[model samples]
Target: MGQRMKPFIILFLNLLLCQSILAPPPPVDYGDSELSLKDVEQLLELYDYEDGLTIDEPQVEIGTLSPIRHKAAIPEPEHTNIFSAEHELPPQKPLPRLPLPPDALGPQTQRGLPTCLLCTCLITTVYCDDLKLEYVPPLPKNTTHFYGRYNKIKRINKNDFANLNKLKKIDVTASQIAEVDEDAFRELPHLEELVIRENQLRQLPELPSTMTLIDASDNKLGRTAIKNEAFKDMDNLQYLYLADNKLDHIPVPLPHSLRALHLQNNNIQEMHEDTFCNSKDMSYIRKGLEDIRLDGNPINLSKTPNAYMCLLRLPTGRLI
Candidate 1:
């Protein structure tokens, strides 16, 4: 009625202005397409959108590293008493063979080595002097004083002092000893000093009344190298050094413990008025018979003036 609804409301407002000007000009945001709810809760808080369904962890190959097992050690029971004493260490006892030294079983040396290793065995004195020694080197049975002087010892064999029972001083002086074995010092029962002086001795063997000093001086002791009552049982004869010997006499019945009777330069001519007194005891006064060395013999002490009464002196040669 106002124009028949005014052209139908103007064709419904021209069909809403042609559907807002043809509909396709709405997409260029330039604000980069618009999200904001804090960018969709920061993109749904950077995606963990769990609606449930995951299953993925298996990548490891940064060149191999996966071996970790461990856990199994428990075995020590071989007899397990821990510490109650197994004690099996007491079987070691085989050690006792050591008894050889008394100077290693004595005697030896002619290069067999052991006379205390070539002479000078001091503990019981064994010198073996001037060792060009031609003999007598086997000594050490507790040899007590034995000086084999200037050796080249020629003969003395009676086992050269057989078993030296503690021989006491036997100086084989100036050796080249011309024979000695009348049992060589007849079994020395502790012989006391027998210096076989300047050797080449003609006799003088059978000795050993435990003689106390009998130096058979410068040898070749003639007159049968004295063996008859040789100082008659030496009664501990004190020093009888037959000087430069080749005696002619005066080895009388001398041992009244004779003091010093060195018959000098022997070949003594004579002397026997009972030799050293006691001429049938004219009150017997041979007081230890003092030093009587008839000088360089060929005697003539005024032809034995009573053979020195009982010697207290006065018998030193040529009293003519």
Candidate 2:
């Protein structure tokens, strides 16, 4: 080898070693949760260099391809792009029309008339309240309840509720009823409630054996208004409200099933020994008579000690 060329070869080898040491390392790939520029700067600041050599933050290329991210598969929506033309939603379907209800009564009947309001509740209840009628409206065959309050009904004929076996409730409040035929309510096999409060009725109709409640308060049910053995057939009678009446005495032999009896504001002055309790049965205890209101009556309640012997609670009346 020529002696002059030896210096040039040594210089060339030294330049190659310097170039290798100064070259930058390859960029690291980060996944989906890649750090931002600030995160990288903080990481660089926290790093303790063994060689004590300071490193400048690497300038990331704007258009470089990011690292491939691995994640769980997600389900696509039904209408992902609702407004997009190709992925647009289909036209909405029109709702089906509902059929009209069956008109049980023919067009000639009194249904939908101005005299009564048909209640769509159980059993097509008929409300004849405030109608100012003199007689009961001809009800449908399947009426469960009849409300004829604030009317001018003077009498209840036998044909009023002739074949209404399904009739359960009859409310003729404040209707100025003067008479009820002996057979007006005798045939209602399922009759439950009879409300004739605030009326001019002198006597109540003969009720069926199926009566559960009877509210004849504020009426003219004088001493003989209630029939002889008025409640003898009502074995299921629970509540009897004859308050605000001219009843000089309680209807005798109240059924054993009576729970509440409201005879307040009456003209009752005394009670027989067997009216509520029997003088014969001392061992009997009338526990079902939990509530009995006679507070506004003319009778002093202390005088009727023997009458209330079988009651669970004494009737409320003027004690003094």
- The 0-to-1 C-alpha lDDT of every candidate, in the order given, reads 0.74, 0.76
| lDDT tens per residue, model 2, 1-320 | 34454444334435434544787423323566654435544553565333333322222348968876987788886765546787777999999987744544311224445223332224558776776778887776777888888889889899887787899999898898888888898888899999988888887778888999999988888888887788976889999999888888888778999999998887888878888887898988998988999887778878768888888787777888
> Candidate 2: minimum summed lDDT over ten consecutive residues — where?
51-60
Model 1 RMSD in angstroms: 25.9
Query: Which candidate's lDDT is highest?
Result: 2
Candidate 1 ranges beyond 4 A from true positions: 1-99, 105-113, 116-141, 145-167, 175-191, 199-211, 219-235, 245-255, 259-281, 285-298, 308-320
What's the CA RMSD for each of the models?
Answer: 25.9, 14.7
**Per-model TM-score versus the true fold:** 0.32, 0.64
Candidate 2, residue 285: the lDDT equals 91
